[model samples]
Structure formats: C-alpha cells, structure tokens
Target: MSAPAAPASRADWPEIRTGIAADVHAFAVDDPGPLRLADLDWAGAPRLSGHSDGDAALHAICDALLSAAGLGDMGEHFGVDRPEHAGRRSADFLAATLRMVRDAGWSVMHVAVQVVTRRPRIAPRRREAEARLTELVGAPVSFAATTTDGLGALGEGDGLLAQAVATLVRPGDPARPA
Candidate 1:
C-alpha cells in the first residue's frame, strides 16, 4: 500500500519565462549594397542604419532572450558606445546573448519574431531566416512579417521594425507532467 507523491506546486515547477522586445532602424540613406536581416543578406535592398549591421529582427530576438534570462538588454552589452561592436554582424550579437543566457543557467526554448516593413518582403526568405536563427540559438525560431497598412514610416518604406518574444527554461529542471 504505497501512496503517490503529491503534485508539485507551480512555484516548485521548472522555471519558465517569456520576454518581449522590439527594435527599429531607419534605412541607411548613405550606405548602399545589401540589407542584413535574421542573419541573411538581401541583395539590392536598402540597408538599415545602426551601430551594427542593423538587423532589426535579430536585435529584437537578442533583447527578448536577454529579458527572458533576466540579463540586461542588448544595449547594455553591445551598445553603440561599444567601439568593438561597430558594424558588427547581428548574428554575433545573438551568439553573445546566448552565452550570457547559458551563463545565467537558462536556455532558450523558442523565439518568434515579426517584421514590419514595406519593402524587401520577408515571405520570400522566411524559411532561410528561421533556419539561420535556429542554427545560431540552437533553438526553434519562427519569423513572420507584415505591413502597417501604409500608415506610418515603416509602411511608407522608411525603415524596418521587428518585435520578438522568447521563451526560456532552466536546464536540468524536472519537466512538468501534462
């Protein structure tokens, strides 16, 4: 006659957290060549202006991951003031962010990002972008894009905007029963 163990309380369950973040970058009026987004290059597309490669999607994902892991935002670690990060690739930011998260005992479970823009539509490259992001974070990443109904600067083709949500879990924690 053995009794089953009591169900674990929510507080005792494995830690799972979600973080949201958004980033925007204006089109680079000066530089002309290709645009970098989600770690992929869009040839003949206008580039976004930023201290880095100006990949808004990747930047938002980094911020979201950091937020979920209770780490500081991207600017704190890779701000414009950081001379070394100037013109750095967005994928580099992602790698560094992942390291910070792992160091904090958290692993990214998933990330979803949405891009808002009027040009260089994302549909054609969604798969490529997701694959690149998943490879970089070692987690599943989803991407989508939309327009602002032609109402604002983004919709008018002035810049790119990206928003992301990330889910994180503490490794080695007991999984919750379904």
Candidate 2:
C-alpha cells in the first residue's frame, strides 16, 4: 500500500513506482494432485488452482506489470476462455507482458511479488520463484513469500492470493536504456 515514488523527479536515484495486482483461485483440493504455480515442485502438498494450469505466481505477476505500464489489466488483454492460453504456461503470460511494456517504450526496473498461502510453507521455493520471474521481466526481480498468518479467510486457509508490484523505467530517459 505504499505510494510509488515520483518517477520524473527522482532521476538521480532509480525512479520508484508501485503497481498492485491481486488474484484468488478456488483450487479443488486433491491429494497427490498437481500444484500449478510455475510447475513448481510442490513437495507433496495439496493442489489448488482454477485454471487449466493453475499458476498463482504467474497470474499475479502478469497483472502487476500490466498495471505498472498503465495498460489494461489481465482480463482486458488475455481472455481466460481463449484457446491460445488454454493449457498454456503462466510463464508465457508474463513474457507477453514484458513484450507489451517494452513496445510501449519502457524498461523494467524490477518487480516485487508476494505469494500467499497457509499450507506446505512456501519459503523453500522462494529463490526458484524469483529466478523464473526475473526472466519473465527480462530483468532482476524480487519474489517474496508471506503467509496470511491466520488473519482472514486466507489466514484460515480457504484459498490462495498473490500480490505484486512492478517498477518500470520510462522511455527516453537519458539515464535509462530500454
């Protein structure tokens, strides 16, 4: 919820900006099922995802980048019903988002993402998650892990939530190159 720092005025320092995007999925619970967040190795936990290939991490990051670029959100760009994305890798969505931003004359500074869950403890997969995300944006990005801490419906462990922030370098900045 922190405000994005001024971009044009803070040229000396990397211009700071914040964009938020969130998503939730009603993952059908099943033991020995596929856990579909980046094809992640789930360490033998319950599976929860609504999409054909349920990837909470990729979905959240896609929205973040689109929001930061002042582009319409995910639904506006990628339709959930489209056959192109059917059984598609969530990573592909993130890659497409990067192409959109670059075409708009901007370079990615970094992205920060949060994956929310109450089971199986996601801390172990944090590094692998970030590496994959960084590749999506074509730059270094941050992926952080946090739990609902038993605070809300998510805290009670009903579903999962992912939130992300994307910072972009505007086009034509002398100090930045796309």
Candidate 3:
C-alpha cells in the first residue's frame, strides 16, 4: 500500500463542530397504559415522566445538537415551568433546534444517540427514533441501543439513560438549503 489514502483534505471539507450529551431520568411507574412493553423486558416496566413525551434519548440528542450549534439548552426555550409547553411534542423542540442551528450558520451533518434502558428495551423503536431525528436534523441520523447490564442506577432499576453526539458542518460557502 503506497501511503494508503492519507484520509481526505480538510481544506476541501466544510468546517465542522461536535458535542456530546448524556442524561437519565426515572420512570413514572404511575402511568396506566403500556407502550410496546413486553415480558422480555426487565422484571418491571415503568412509564417515563416529563413535560414532553419524556423520551430522554430524544431530549439528550436535541440538547447535544443545540449545544454544538451554540444554541441555548432545552429548558431555556422549552422548560416544564412554562405552561405554554406543558404538553408540546419533543419533535417540535428538535425541529426548532435544527432551524436555530441553520440560522446560527451551521448545518447538522449527523447525530448519534444511545438510549439505555433495562425495561421496555430500546432496540425495537430505534429506527423510528432515527427517522424522527433525521426529520429534524435535515440529514442522516444514527442511533444505538444499549443496557447498563446491571451496572448503574438505571441498571439498578431507578431510571434510564440517554446519551447523544451531534456533529455539525459549517457551510463551506454559506450555501442555502433548497
């Protein structure tokens, strides 16, 4: 191999920024209904609680994207304390973040997320989550599912964890999206 490929020239690539985020929240255990719950899950399944849909994964991913783009965190824009967003959709928040990212002179090149749960395994709905992220980021989004393996508070049965990474691209020539 004569020098392999030397990777690619950054001079030709758009400027990019990246950020990481992680979060965990306790399960509701109070909601009456079940969502895709099955016996294969941990001993018990508790509903998640939050102002929005309570999807820690989505929330964390959105925060990562906003942070990478220099936008404010979720609470500053849509916090539980604000009654106006008492029951809004988390997707909306991500969408707003996407717009803000673009407005702030950046584009979401990609995002990756991991949703950790002992019960109601995340493997099943991972694709759906990726699709939702794609819609917001205006590009391909990747997702992964993992378990604490009885290692953390989440594994101990207190709650779940959501971690995310967002990679943003600064336009090479400030081209507008069509």
Candidate 1 ranges with C-alpha deviation above 4 Å: 1-7, 171-178
* Alpha-carbon shift of residue 158 in model 1 (angstroms): 0.3
Per-residue lDDT of model 1, residues 91-138, tens digit only: 889898999999898978999999998878788889998998899889
Total clashing pairs for each candidate: 0, 1, 1
- In TM-score terms, candidate 3 sits at 0.78
lDDT of 2 at 108: 81
* Pick by lDDT: 1 or 2, better one: 1
What clash count does candidate 2 reach?
A: 1
> Residue 96 in model 2: shift from native, Å?
1.2
Cα lDDT tens digits, model 2, 35-148, are 776446575555666544667767877888888778888777777777676767777777788898789767788777777878657678778877876766677877776786
Candidate 2 CA-lDDT value: 0.72
lDDT of 1: 0.89
Using all chains and alpha carbons, the TM-scores for the candidates as numbered come to 0.90, 0.79, 0.78
Ranking by lDDT: 1, 2, 3
Choose 1 or 3, whichever is better by TM-score.
1
Residue 149 local lDDT, model 1: 91
